[model samples]
Target chain A: MKPHTLSVLVENRPGVLSRVTGLFSRRGFNIESLAVGTCEEPGMSRITIVVIGDDAKVEQVMTQLHKLIDVIKVSDLSENERVERELALIKVNAEPGTSRAEILQIASIFRALIVDVGSKSVILEVTGDTEKIDALEKLLRQYGVKELVRTGKIGILRGSKSVPGSK
Target chain B: MKPGAKILVESLPREGTEIIFGYPGGVVLPIYDELYDSSLRHILVRHEQAAAHAADGYARASGRVGVCLATSGPGACNLVTGIATAYMDSAPIVAITGQVPTNLLGNDAFQESDITGITMPITKHNYLVKSAADISRVVQEAFYIAGTGRKGPVLIDIPKDVSTGLAEDTPLPEKVTLRGYNPTYKGHKRQIDKAVELIVHAERPLIYAGGGVIASNASAELVSLATLVGIPVTTTLMGIGCIPCDHPLNLGMLGMHGTEYANFAVMESDLLIAIGARFDDRVTGKIDTFAPHAKIVHIDIDPAEIGKNKRIDVPIVGDVKAVLQDMLSGLKKNNAYEPWLKKIKHWKQHHPLRVKDDGRLHPQYIVRALSELVKGEAVIVSEVGQNQMWTAQHFCFHHPRTWITSGGLGTMGYGFPAAMGAHFARPDVPVFDIAGDGSIQMNIQEMSTVAANKIPVKVAILNNMYLGMVRQWQELFFDRRYSFTELPPVDFVKIANAYGIDGMRVDSPDDVVPALKASLDCNGPVVMDFRIEREENVFPMVPAGAAINEMIGGHPRS
Candidate 1:
């Protein structure tokens, strides 16, 4: 099953997030990643969900999401010309020698920021599309990645067309 | 200033609620106190589950939002099954629950439960009202949500403090405006035209209607659509009574335990027009082989239901009544299906519904007797299993809302409480709960509820002294290893009498009619126990996972 990104706009109300996510688990839809935050509107929130399913199954997921009373709109951003990004923090084991310089060069090539530095370890903060993040993480694995965390992918359409109610 | 409890009480009549079924508890005493001084008629029930089922029954019978109330924790938890039943069947009900005080909500206080969290999966929508002022608006919105578009149960949980807390005395909203919850009522023009084209050309078109027809009050439109094109109609269990059982073009209930002719028609049809019915597995046995040759046109209010279980050639999302009306306007009289109708007629004549008569009382015979006495006029509610199937099979319903059963969830104890709710909704008509001995005892405590209120509901127990459906399954599939399916007989008549209700036990075939008549003649609730044949099984059965055409046990003549 291919992963499809869904940009969902919902009311900024208590328990609305659980209502949307609960539907996914109950219906047996596989969610690859999810991100949520308040939108431009005062009482609205935007949630980006990456779900794994075929076209028909994903279509059913969209329809089921619309059934929730708190959901204002659900747009499949995967189909449109869009920009996506994921923020990740990775701490790498860097000795007091060539490993440290090599890690700095790798982070510079990926245009990542060195957010924190210890005597023997350095934490790099990176923001990019999912594929770019995966590529950078793969390069740093040889230096013994110590700890890592990622904010799941969030997406938006490229043009002036915004999800209804998000503006 | 007014208390939230008073506002909650005052909101019911404004929303057209004439009656409610509820049980009192500690946290809800404030609301009950307000109810005591209010004009709303509250019927106290023995169990909270009964209160919810009764509300569901009332909703199904009257085509309005039925209301039920309960206190916190176990009380709210007890309403879960009933709420799920209504949710599965698309019955509109609003359940109000009292909660622990706001401060004690998460502190493991006495009688505290996460009811909203518990019911989130079942309810169409729910609210945990934190403020006293939100009561009126929440109540208005709850009713609106419950009664509109793919109707189902909605819950409102008010903490005890919110109910007793004071709020500004404001007027109830004249109209509810939910930006995210608008439901489409009209069908798309292009979709309607496509459906009409299919109907006009189909050689063997069948109308498969469901409870959506009843929910939309579109039984007349459904009949018109079928008659205008000379197409025959069949129904799911929830779709019973949507078309008159005696209608010449109606093929009766379809799928598992359905009529032989209906299953045959579905198997052979070229076009299947499904209205308001989800393709439940029981209705579409072995989904790949169901309606094998039919190019399906599914019309439902819920967009999610379309293509959920089966592929659709034309999917129309709108209110069933409106879609039918639009399709009718686009069509002319056509007799293209005459040959198809003749084939179905042959099937019906060759394999009519039959039951063996060995001089002992059969459940089907008792149901047929009740059908004859009611004359297609009374509301017949049924519990799950053999009793439900027999009632759906034998009862001749002339109009919609006359047949009520838990079709989706198949909750066993649904009938009696639902029958009481139906009686309250339509007091001018007779209501009967056709229950099995096993299922009736699930909520038998409601006998006291009916007796205390003096509601004249008749209970017909088909006593087989076993969990007859499971036994039939075991007998057919597992070499008759009974495996704890049998129950030690308890005197149901004595139990009925103990509740201060009239009751009788009938064993012989001749006593079936007289016992039914005697129960009908009683002024208060009466329980008539019919000692039916223990080994009787509902025939024309499609074994689970088998194709609809692969049915067994329906002999041509019995």
Candidate 2:
């Protein structure tokens, strides 16, 4: 089974999200990762959802999503020329003198920014592909990471031609 | 300038809403007051559940948006199952509910329930009208959404204050545009061509038609396409009357309770041209093995159903009638299926739908007798399960919208209320609810509505004294451990008499015909209770999860 990433355009209406998600649950579909944001089109939102299932089932989910009234359009953005980004924040248990310098040096090499400083911890913010962020978090874990957070995958279609909505 | 209540009341005739099935209570008192003065008709049902079913039945029978209303809390909650039933079956219905006053909302005031929240999963779309001025537009949109695109139920929740308020506009908008909701009415030309290419080449093509054929009024086109292509046609339960039962190519129902010949035809066919039918589990049985040899061409207005259950070789997503018309217009007339027809005829001759009629009284016999008396001109609604199966097998249905049943949801007690709905839609036609003892009792209170409204519907109860369908399953699969399937003996005729309707009990096979005749001869609603064989089971059943071809009980040819 391959994972299919669906880029869905929908009306920004109350309960539309619930309806879409509710449909998935009722139909016994699993959602791996999802991210939603206002798109280039006014009053419309773009939702990128990653679903892992057999080709037939994934296709069924896409077709069912199309039936929802608020859903404007749905496109599989997986193989399309598209850029995806995920943001991560990691707080490491680094003491001021003993490990702060080493942590800052390692973070800089990965182009991650040291967003916060404290006597007992260092907060590093990383914005990159999911794989890159995963690698940075793995390295940060060796120094006793306090906490880590990630905004799931958000992507857009490539080229100048827009994903049609109310532009 | 009218209050929102009056506007909502006035909106009925504007949309051609003739009658409403509803129950009144506190929050909707204003709306009820308005209804009292308006010329629009209302039939107060015993429960909100019946109201939704009646409305759904009305929609199915008349091809119009049926309307129903209820007050808040339990009233709206009762409509839940009915709405879900309609939703699953794609019945066009608009359900209105009165919410608590705007100021008291979320405070959990008396008789207040989050009805909009409760019905979100069931309705195609819903509205919570907080403003009085928005009443007209909301009504318009609700009707529009409910009656279009894979039509299903829609809900409108109006707070008491909105109905009572009196702020106004000059005129309701002539048009309302939903930027997101545009239904694809025309099939894609390329897809249609691909289907035609597949159809022209396949030797054993079968037309699998469903409720969508009736919903789209495409029986004419369906018949034309089947005849032109020289393919045999098999109908789903909801598609029974798409072609006359006696038609040469008609192969009865397909799936679990389907005819043996029909199931065999499906299994052996190389090409499956599915028109407006979803491949439900009942039809497919073991999904992996279902139509294993067939190349599928599915045409449905609902894009969701095109490849939802089974894989599709050619998917034309549009109205069934429109797409069928396109296919008919484009295809060259070719009768290339003589071999296929001969093979099917051989199977039909060998595995005809028959039962051991060692009849004291049999439900199938009664159904056949009733059909013969009516001559395929009556409207037949059935309660779900064995009775439904029997009617699907034996009833001589000849027209669209004549056979109505809750096929998708399989909701018991849907028959009588739905018959009431169908009666209202076609007052001149004879309506019969062929029900099982178990299913009829589910909403027998509707007898009150029937009697009061003087709806000339006949309730033919096959009194098996048990939940026969479930019992049959238990007997076959679970070693005869019948648990909770046996129903207590209740005299349905006496109950009907108590409801102020004439009724009779038929105990012998000889009485079945006379009982049916007497019931039909009555002026108003009549219940004919036939004490059918207690242990009889629906035959040609493909046991659950078994392949469609592996059905259990049709005798081989002599």
Best by TM-score: 1
Residue-level lDDT of model 2, residues B1-558, one tens digit each, is 668899899887898899999999998999999999889999999999999999999999999999999999999999998999999889999999999999998999999999988888888988889888988888898888888888999999999999999967547667767876778889999999999899889999999999999999999899888877788999999899998898889999999989888998899899999988999888889998988889999999988787777889999989998899999987877778898899889888888877557857888888899999999878899999999999999898999899999998999999999999999998888999999999999999999999998998999999899999999999999999999999999988789999999989889989888888887778899998888899999998898889998888876533
- Fnat for the candidates in order: 0.70, 0.60
Single out the weakest 10-residue window by summed lDDT for candidate 1 chain A. Answer: A158-167
Docking class of 2: acceptable
Task: State the C-alpha lDDT per candidate.
Answer: 0.93, 0.89
TM-score, one value per model: 0.98, 0.95
> What residue pairs are clashing in model 2?
none
Best-performing candidate as measured by DockQ? 1
Evaluated on chain A only, model 2 obtains a TM-score of: 0.92
Q: What is the TM-score of chain B alone in each candidate?
A: 0.99, 0.98
Show pairs that collide, candidate 1: none
**Candidate 1 residue-wise lDDT at A57:** 84
lDDT of 1 by residue, B70-107 (tens): 99999999999999999999899999999999999889
